[model samples]
Target: MKIRQLQFFFLAIFFVLILSGCGSSSATKEDKVIKIGATAGPYSDQVTEGIKPLLEDKGYDVEVVEYTDYVQPNLSLDQGDIDANVFQNSLYMKDFAETRGLDIIEAIKVPTAPIAIYSEKHDSIDDVEDGQSIATSNDPVNQARALAMLEDLGWIKLKEGVDPTKASEKDIAEYIKKVEIKPLEPAQLPRAMSDVDYSFVNGNFAISSGLKLNGAVYLEKTPPHYMIGVTVRESDEDAQFVKDIIEAYQSESFKKLNEEDEKYEGYVLPEWMN
Candidate 1:
């Protein structure tokens, strides 16, 4: 009876030690894991090429999560599925979080690819003809951006004293080219190049579809607000990983990668990098 009791005592101690060790290991692994979210194209490449290696060097196990749509990355971050995201501009982030009741914030701006006018039917802006058609984003914010570009190109004229950020098709005071402006889904805008005389393609979608930046007929002068950044939950805004991400983005290595790579050509760089 004494021997059996001692054996049971030893077995209990062993199990406790094993369980405690496993718990510590699990905690350490969890601490080292960092999941970043980005869209399927250049943004994801930014994570895979620019951010991931830097975090890995700091002993983190980085995972780049690719999202197909604009909303899911923010939703996943709010739900704790991803640690950070690098897809949307600060203005878009603010609007999204405000409307959806998600507590999120932008960490820092990354190199952003500007939206540009693309065409399969025309080679240059000079080729634009009156009464032709142009497809652009249907979303109010992006549509406003496209309209602003058209105005700059002397293809249209917006109303006096109109807020450029909020300007829409209705704000166009004059059609300098008399072209029909068709607003379509952003993803479909690339394909619309086939059907319309021209389409304004968002940078990410254009790059994903193998359209080069140099192929654009006219690129927008991307404003700082339109620049995309790394986003995180509000609570995690000051976390070490978030700080590291900012540091990585502002690092010389990242700047070199962006400057030297043909893949990143024409991307509007952040102020720090400039």
Candidate 2:
């Protein structure tokens, strides 16, 4: 009886060891998997259409996760729920990560569409009238860009010596055109077009909502940092997967897609592409 009991115990130990080994191997394989998160739209399309194929060719199992809100992607990335994200510009990502105490960094800048003043009410920017309302994002980074663009168009004047990157409605020193600025969520700007005289629409939101970049009354000449970037945790900076992702964005295939695809029409090409 004792001998039989010893044999059964050793058999159980062997099975447990085998299971443990299998689990360890599965984890090792999973480390090669790359998961990317993006807002549901152009950025997600970028991963599915542009980045995924290239990385898969290199033998990485790539999964793209889509989020609707701006906050969740970074939170997911920070918590290791996703490996990378491809929605936000460098400035916005930097500010967000800093504010949330998340350690993330942009791996590469992607070709981006520029935010623009879209108007259903006017045919051109020259048709501007005083007291008309323009919709803009309430977020500081984007609102600053919109306000600065208005300033550039001679419609608004920001207070002297204010940082243009951080400018807000409160910083408006004068209303050159006396237009009311309506601050809304970035995604809501596209829908607000019919009600407002002009709405500042983010590029991703614009493209996702079936609006064309060329159809805008005015498009921004996007700054380099304002271009959307692929972000990963700072600890992953030296990882092989991160390097592969960077290579994928810089690949000729991606450039060709952007050049030929009607979906990407009027997008501001990154400096590297130019």
Candidate 3:
């Protein structure tokens, strides 16, 4: 009787071990995998450097897809090539979707990096001499932002009722300082700072060129609508994967990266995250 009882006990322990192994395999199989698409530079770095590890800790396999062009991230998301994208801000994405007919939607706002005007020759806008040259991006979107920054700086007055998003050089109603507007490629603006009286530099390009945000003579206060977000397909908005991404983004670790890292310097966190 004692020998039979011992054999039964050993058999039960063996069965339990097999069941535990099966459970572990099931959990591994259930791990969610998601891919995010973003442009090169800070946006990509935010994921690859920060969010990627956090999600991995939660058993998510995260893939960050990078694109150099502005158009393809939305196109890829719309076609299900990626689960999400983190490239353009809300306003630009809205304009891109309306024009391209892509059905992408903003899921959650990410940190903002604003357009800034830097002056190497002048301490302030008031110091700019009359008829001096100021350079801005030749691209229309950035040029519009540069114009808006100039208007806010009181250097020029845009036409009354001119939409800031669509404003152009022709929309300048008055030159407060008689400064000439020189449109140049955004990448060249950082280098052009020495050449022009003042240069409008996009945030990412500025950071890459070793320009510090603290050195800007003027920086635009980005509106909530101008903040970047995790853009996703309408169909995937309610998915648990989407929630996981947002949670990972809003984590304390993510905030710490912006606070402690030079790469994320001058990033403005979303109001909701605050």
- As for lDDT, the candidate ahead, 2 or 3, is 2
Residue 265 accuracy (lDDT) in model 3: 71
- RMSD to the native, candidate 2? 4.3
- The residue-by-residue lDDT of candidate 3 on 14-89, one tens digit each, is 9999999999788666547788998667788888988899888888888999875667889988887788998777
Misplaced by over 4 Å in model 2 are 1-24
Off by over 4 Å in 1: 1-28
- In candidate 2, where is summed lDDT lowest over 10 consecutive residues? 265-274
Q: Per-residue CA lDDT of candidate 2, range 206-255, in tens?
A: 98888988899899989897999999999999988999999999999999
lDDT score at residue 105, model 3, on the 0-100 scale = 84
What would the per-residue lDDT of candidate 1 be over residues 98-209, giving only the tens digit for each residue? 8899999988989999998898888888998998999988877788888988988899999999988779898999998999999998888888888999999889989998
TM-score of each: 0.88, 0.90, 0.79
Highest-scoring model, TM-score: 2
- Rank candidates by TM-score, best first: 2, 1, 3
Backbone atom clashes (below 3 Å) for every candidate: 0, 0, 0
Worst 10 residues of 3 by lDDT: 26-35
